[model samples]
Target: MGTVWPDVRLSDSGDEAPTSPQRSHLIGGHDSKSYLAICSESAVNWLKARVSSADEQSVTDIVTRLSRHADYKSTFMCPPKLKQFPEPDMQMAWKYCQEYFDNRVETLFGAIDRRQFEARLRAHLQDGDNSDSDPSWYALRNTIYATGTRLLLTRTGCDAKTIHESAMQYFLNALSVHTQVLFARQVDLTGVQALTIMSFFAENLLGSSIESMLCSNAIRVAQGLRLNYEPVSNERLSPSDRFVGNRIWWALYCYDKHISLRDGRQSCIDDDDISCALPERQASENPNKFEIFMQMIKSAQIQSLIYKKLFSAAGRRQNTIQERAAVEQLDQALSEWRDSLPLHLRPGAPIKKSSLPAGVHIDPVVYMHYTYYGTVIAMYNKFPWTARGSSLDNAAFGREKAVSAARSVVLATRYIDTDMNTTGCLLFSYPMTALIVLFVHILQNPLAPSAHSDVVLMDMATGHFAQLEFATSMQLEVQFVRDMAHIARRAVEQIRRDAWIDVTPFEAPEPAIFSPTMTGPNLNFMDFLTDDVYAV
Candidate 1:
């Protein structure tokens, strides 16, 4: 592309134009690359001359000229070069910058409007055509996504509101087209476009229109889909698709009103206007509610929508209210037990035992669910649990399922201890059932480690606890057994120790050794534990 220069004539127009016209443009407005270079050069010049006050207006005029070029206006803002420009009075620079940007946006829109860009693009979409199946479709859409976002952010001097509104309209339209393409089973189109759209939104407009655009079903569809272009007879899919899909879907719920691990307001893309989405933290209180909300979304019930549905569906096959009430009783009991622990003593408390910690700690609830149930639920939701003639075998899977659950309990324990905190028994103090539910909730979390400690399992189920055990030990079972011995000796040696409480035997059961038989689908561990053999 050649640079565009303004043609000028002398008052002696009657005379032959000077051998060459005095072209008064910053750099010849030419190809996109050149335009970018010129704009960048002018921006630098404008920045350098500031200290000396050498022709500030002239330098500004050059910048204005660069901004006036069509290609430069579109592509120059987001590249690292523009962002790195020496800090200028951005607000003040707008006086000249505004004229340059206003002209650029007006020109681009004028061309688009005149050419009816949307109308032309819409022609490509045919009913049942499966356009999303074409990778090129997303390639094109991504280009628009990047270009449109750049226009919103870099277009100087434009009303922030107007730019924001226009950007949102384009985003919404893209989302609509994306959904149509996905439902039409153009997997290729939906996959690429959706991912590009998501990546751009996450990277560029994360706080504002991008996130809100995603909050709707658009995010869910984008995350749920696994697009494949490679030919495979046996339904092979790329890891990237599954990974992106799960992340996008998980992110939607991750930020849902219920999840509380992080302040939603804080999670709001800082640049975007998420004031309406994020609740304000009060001055006087800890902003732990958001963390609590994060935990709920990561919970098994929400994470494993399919299993939850199956659990609900299985309810219709049950025999009596007494049987149903038994399960309900356990959940209610667990909830009550959790409520009784002090906040500091609760799961996810700091290992340091200080009034202040350097960084915020993970919410026990979010960490537990996301580690355990979230991983499995996310996987099972996308992949079929049963395929033709492998014949769904819940019976055989039940024991493995129990192992999986136990592993999750162990894993959540490890995660809570290793990653979230190195020196806290906070999660270990939870009731066995709450621990079990929390374990179930996190059984599927991909981020959770497969490895877990046998000792932590023992402590969570036992009542023997001491400050030393609490502060000193990393493994719950080791601490439990240790505490039990000390308690027994103290009570035996001194009646004063007995005044506090009687010593009890340690009854921490080994992992998955005595899983309750599933009465259809729900395992009744309470009944199994209350049985004569387990008691002995």
Candidate 2:
């Protein structure tokens, strides 16, 4: 059986009379202890202890419940064959394809070549039902349709429910051919791209674990094709084909690092194994076009290093001094990455609405900041606190960094348009983490000047989730966050009330000591006399 910490016992009556200020005979004045200072310290400590304990149990319960509902196996196994699915609406499909290329495609590290993909799509549509058609191509087309439909949810006249069903139908159509694409003897490049796209679609509907598995499978296939290495100039591949291959490989690399860090799992792609060069902008393209994508890839590299040098099991075994050094090194690297970005793309840089290109979506810009701030929070959120003399000061500095990052995440939400496509989990997870941090801050310092405003920001985040629920089938997760926000609000109110009350200081009763008898076969009575036994 697990042992529980003994509770701090209170007075038998459960209420004690407040003590009057003690007089000092030597100074002929009241004691040096300030009533308000003691009260504040006592309240903060009491709340911190209770909040820490409750957070642990709450997190465990929440994780267990979520795990039970997660569908890990379905993503790996072949999807059930559908007896009947809607015939392709060729015009609508083309429309979605165009929408994807025009707006969404720029945001991702490249996968499909626009001109080549369109020509093939035209031929595929013309060929209609030909036995020679590639199953992988069919899956890729459907995945694009699904992505496009979901992205245009707000622009359509149909009700959100209807639009959502249509999107899922396209996704299901793509998933139905999962086996053909995944189990092919000679893995096609299109198959790898399809799997990559499907994994992202799954992440919005399913969860990170399912997405991780699909991404791992995609990486495996890409590796099988040697996409991890740059193509030789002598190869028969065209310049465009080579560039597309490079883009796809880096896309997989960026995503592998992202999902691994997000899920606390090992990355599928190893930095040591990668020799692929970063994709460059074509001569015909605008010089600044791929800047954001390149920056994201760089950021992902930092994230990979962060997991390797800090969060990995081996890294966790490092001494406090070594850990601090690792953190500082990573922090410097991250700072350099941000600084290397263009002035307009920096984390807190202000964007002029008029300066954005025609039809350009701000989502990518918002995502850059989210990723940057999220990385900052991840670095410091779980930093260790030791018993050394400077530990308290170091902890305070770390906490400040984390809190500042959290605030930045919450503040960035204002830039997110209500009608914007936020079906991705990162869109929700970053703000959710920020909200929880603010919630805890209010609990720890209920009378803080920003406490009331923090509650407002939390409400904004909750409302953001409510909006996103209409775009994606994440009602359960959103509702869970809502319930948590409700509980946090109530806790703030109670803490604030208690803070103002003039109550007696809490004094814990003496703990009852326990002496255990040793009778086990391996027990040695002499062991008790060792210095280690009395160290406690």
Which prediction has the highest lDDT against the true structure?
A: 2
Displacement of residue 298 (Cα, Å) in model 1 is 5.6
Q: Candidate 2: which stretches are off by over 4 Å?
A: 1-84, 105-108, 130-133, 206-209, 233-239, 350-352, 357-360, 383-394, 418-420, 444-450, 470-477, 501-536
Using TM-score, give the best candidate's number. Answer: 2
What C-alpha RMSD separates each model from the true structure? Answer: 28.7, 18.0
- What are the models' TM-scores? 0.24, 0.75
Task: Give residue 323's lDDT in candidate 1 (0 to 100).
Answer: 32
Candidate 1 lDDT, tens digit per residue, 390-458?
222222342243344443333333223321112112232222222322222222221122213222343
Error of 1 at 288 (Å): 18
lDDT of each: 0.30, 0.59
Candidate 1 Cα errors over 4 Å, as ranges: 1-167, 183-185, 189-298, 301-536
Q: What's model 2's lDDT at 163?
A: 57
Question: How would you encode candidate 2's per-residue C-alpha lDDT over 229-325 as one tens digit per residue?
Answer: 7686315446666778788888888878876665456789989988878888877554455776788799999999988987677966777788888
